[model samples]
Target: MSTFIAAFLFLLVFFLLMSIGYLIKRKAVQGSCGGLGVLGIEKACDCDEPCDRRKAKDAKEKARQERLAQHRII
Candidate 1:
């Protein structure tokens, strides 16, 4: 029937729009990094400062923990 054909066309258009939207969304997702980093996009630091800070903090913590463990062992 004509009604059936119209409905089918409507559904086809709807699905095509949905597919295009999904493709655009997929492309956007692929383009973005999901913001999973220490710095943001604007101030993204590729320098060694953050790495140095992290290493220094880790070393300090390790030294403190080792000192405590040595005391406990005594």
Candidate 2:
């Protein structure tokens, strides 16, 4: 019947669009923080371990402080 054909066409188009979306997501680069970094906010890692970016920032800050302390003796 015509009703059955229309329903089948609608479902087919819906599934095709879903498949395209899935493919796009799979090819895209995944962000660590759900795009919070783009908004200038620090994104926490979802892993059990500390984030590498956080560790690197901490290390950089510690180095800068040490340098400042060394210069203060002059």
Candidate 3:
């Protein structure tokens, strides 16, 4: 329909303009209210000891880092 095409074009242009503004600013997007920093909390999941899921994620990250380190020639 003509009405639908007009509305779609308007939205497409609006989104393109918003994206251009963001690209010019080059800033990371964050919640409007800030986040854990506002509450003075550090890590998202801060436990005395990490849970199983957290442990696995950490181990995976560690392994990834080690693999990257191994690939380094210098």
Off by over 4 Å in 1: 27-74
lDDT of 1 by residue, 38-57 (tens): 34543345554568776798
lDDT values of the candidates? 0.71, 0.77, 0.85
- lDDT per residue (tens digit) for residues 1-74 in model 2: 99999999999999888789877664444567667667665645544566788789878989998998888644
Lowest lDDT block of 10, candidate 3: 25-34
Worst 10 residues of 1 by lDDT: 27-36
- Taking all chains together, the TM-score of candidate 2 against the true structure is 0.35
Considering lDDT, where higher is better, how would the candidates rank from best to worst? 3, 2, 1
Model 2 scores a C-alpha lDDT of: 0.77
TM-score per prediction, in order, is 0.35, 0.35, 0.44
Q: Of models 2 and 3, which has the larger TM-score?
A: 3
lDDT score for candidate 3 against the true structure: 0.85
